[model samples]
Target: MILVAADRVLGRGGALQLQIETVAGDAGVEVDAVRARFPDVLALATAVLRFRQEQWLTGLAAAAVGISEPRDRILALFSYLESCFMDDDWRGCAFINGYGELGRAEPTIAALADEHLASIETHLRALCIEAALPPYVADGLSLLVQGAKVEAAIHGTTQPARSARMTAAMLMSVYEPAREDLFI
Candidate 1:
């Protein structure tokens, strides 16, 4: 039911009241019980944001299987990006959507979303370091990832992920000359 709520809330641009009512109707519970369970809408939104992040990270990890080489890891990351774009539940990004809907009206929700993005950035940075790539590469890739998400949502296609992957491969070639053969 929480998953349903998250999807509806994000899909409808953070209509918390409506989403809660919908959840209540779907769950056959009273609206008051839903409210009692989630006294703070922002808190519920935060949990949904965290849940979305975990979903993304889990996908990334699964895509990165047997990825020992840095170049392979980059490819894996790009594959993950494509998968995210292709997901039936894809709606830009949960954090970005949450921020767009509630950032101005609810600072706490915005902060939670910001923290979630930062966590993703930190994880990507760690991957860059593990790959022995320059530190800035992580930031660059993070931007690419975000851009691809937005583009994918707007175009309703996975082409953005493919484009980003090609660009990332070029960047990787420059960063690790020894791995140039891998890309070819």
Candidate 2:
């Protein structure tokens, strides 16, 4: 409950704004109750960060559930994110924000941020390998995804995801000449 409240708070503002009192109130529990579970704002923030990151990955997996083709599975994940871009409350990725806000002050946040990025890379790489795509496809797709994420967050538009999706298709086609028709 506390972590969910913290995530809601984080969804509204930066990590620094996540307060124990706010969480307690949102969670419908006493401040002491909230404190009993999370001794400090940093600890609460850390838990929420992990929660959101895991939720993101789980949701991505769920998105690709019915997908059979490896390349389609990868595209399905990006399409899931493209749909997320339609959410009005979306404020970019919380893990990335957590790192930007308090990563230097707290090493754990930095480590968790690194872990989340690495997980994303691993997922992309695994999908690319399954698709028999060039190794560079996964690396390039990761870069494009990260770049698109930043742009979408800053500009409050879905164009970044569309551009990233198009560029990813183009990149894959380069390594998969036989599938050029599918790409087009």
Candidate 3:
């Protein structure tokens, strides 16, 4: 529903300029000064920065999809996201293009995005350690999970997430037969 709402807003606004202005206004920010001074490209960069910061909170909270426990939150969020973007043309999506468009103009957003991705990757690596997996295998798992996010977005399906889960389970069977550390 949030994605749908965002899509609606994007459709109605027609341009990043309008979207930024509306978003700023919704947040009760006086963007008039910024709007008057910066060109559309500049404003877009600023909006992208703000958008990424906001996304961090959403990502951490698992978008409030109702799974409150940390482990459940991660699984549910990934599961739903996998289901959400499971479209046939997901791969052809312009995620990189859009990311580049935002990054080229907004260095701050680019930097923050890099930081966020790294933080999340570390979180995954820590989970691997908790599962008692070897460091290299844990790193591989972390990369696999991260890569699945991109794959899910590109393929528009939950298959990537499911694949990640299956792969993780297989690795666990080899490295952690007891499943003593896993909560679920």
Candidate 4:
């Protein structure tokens, strides 16, 4: 239902009440029932946002880290991001969009978005460690991931993913010498 009413939920300056009603109708449920089931709409929306964000992040992590070579892993990650950008249903990062929509109104939603982004950072950090890259490389890659998402969404193009991939390759090259020094 979120996908069905994404325009209403994510579009500029719509009344929350009307958005909820439209979502409820699309979901084939009474608005009152939806309200009864989730009195705190922000919390419910945050949960959905987290779910969607984690889904993509986790999938990307798995695809990246599942490969054997460091360069291959980075390529895998870039490929995944490119595919996401090209997806017909792609509508940007859900957490980012949700935060833009509800962050100021609901602090909990903001916190949830932060937590979700942090989780992605943690996962990327782990991948960096596994790849024997410098610790700070994870942070740079995380920023690249986020920037690519925003750029792709805004421009409706996969160019950002390609650029991010080139950046990641450069970062990996800088840290490649340290690979043998790390215990992991």
Candidate 5:
């Protein structure tokens, strides 16, 4: 319950931005209850981030399930991200927001974010290899998706993903001469 409340706090700002009392109120529990579970905000924040990582990997699997084609599978992942950007319940990624807040100040915090990002990179690299494209494609597409998330949050819209997806498709087609069209 405390983790869920802290996750809600994460959308508005960084993970550690909220006070214990605020999180307690959000959790509908007493401050002591929250403290009993979490000795401090840092502990609570770390737990929430860890919780978010599991959810993210699970969602990533679901996003690509039942999709066989390498390119379509990658695009399906991007489209899933598009829908996620549009979701009203969860605005920004917990991992992104965490790094934005902590930066290099905390190694553990940064690792949490890096681990999540590497998971995305792994998925992208797999698809790129499957399509017989250069490994650089995964790196490029990963940056696009990361930037798209920040862009969507800044503009209060999800057009960034659409634009990024188009750019990705074009890049793939341009790099592979045999494929007439990669854009969907």
Candidate 6:
């Protein structure tokens, strides 16, 4: 275990140390700690943590939003994705790696991801009730959306988004009517 100091701004315009353990021991400590020792350390840490939470929530929301009316669901999905891409640190993006540090540690990104997934599941169930659709159908749609996200991110394309949109369209196409009003 390596002790890395994450500096926090003090009352007198100085800084304090916040020690974090790193996998690469001293080397990692030096690199990660250097950035943390700034005057606005606490603010920097907060920003980083919040960004991580938002990223995790965005992915979860993309699927969970479908539990509402189609318009609202699509709105939620679009809003979250917009936040993600607009983030300053986004580099074509990647998924969170370690879960251990998040919930218990200062950042708590992993916990955010875990909680967001549960929320998504709940949203799907609620949407089903609202749509008067079978509960199992909602469950299936949620699973499909999850799969689409994973595949899209893995392949580094918009295919996942397209697939998810198609799946949602299918769900909304429950009515076999030959009228435009019956289409989603």
The local lDDT score (0 to 100) that residue 7 gets in candidate 3 is: 30
Which one is best on lDDT?
2
| lDDT (CA) per prediction | 0.76, 0.85, 0.51, 0.71, 0.83, 0.46
Model 6, residue 153: distance off in Å is: 1.8
**What would the per-residue lDDT of candidate 1 be over residues 1-184, giving only the tens digit for each residue?**
7556645655555434436667666567787877886765665676677677787779888888887886677678888889877777676887787778787798877887788778768877887787778878888888888898889988999999999999888877777646577889
Of 1 and 6, the candidate ahead on TM-score is 1
Clashing residue pairs found in predicted model 1: none
Model 4 residue 87 lDDT score: 78
Question: 1-184, model 5: which lDDT tens digit per residue?
Answer: 8888887877665665667888898999999999999898878888888888887778778988898888887787778779888889666777777788874787888988898899889989999999878878999999999988888877878898899889889888866736456664
Checking candidate 2 for backbone clashes, the offending pairs are: none
Top model by TM-score, which number? 2
Please, what is the TM-score per model?
0.85, 0.92, 0.55, 0.79, 0.88, 0.46
lDDT of 4 by residue, 1-184 (tens): 5433534454333224335666676667777766775565564475456566666768776776657876577567777989888877676776676677677787877887798789768867876877888677888998998899889989989999999999988888886554455786
| 3 or 5, greater by lDDT | 5
List runs of model 1 lying over 4 Å from the truth: 12-18, 177-184
For candidate 6, the 10 contiguous residues with the lowest summed lDDT are 3-12
Clashes of each: 0, 0, 6, 0, 0, 2
Better of 4 and 6 by TM-score: 4
lDDT over C-alpha atoms for residue 173 of model 4: 80
Q: State how far residue 114 of model 5 sits from its true place (Å).
A: 1.7
What is the TM-score ranking, best to worst? 2, 5, 1, 4, 3, 6
Off by over 4 Å in 6: 1-111, 175-184
Model 4 misplacement above 4 A: 1-18, 61-66, 178-184
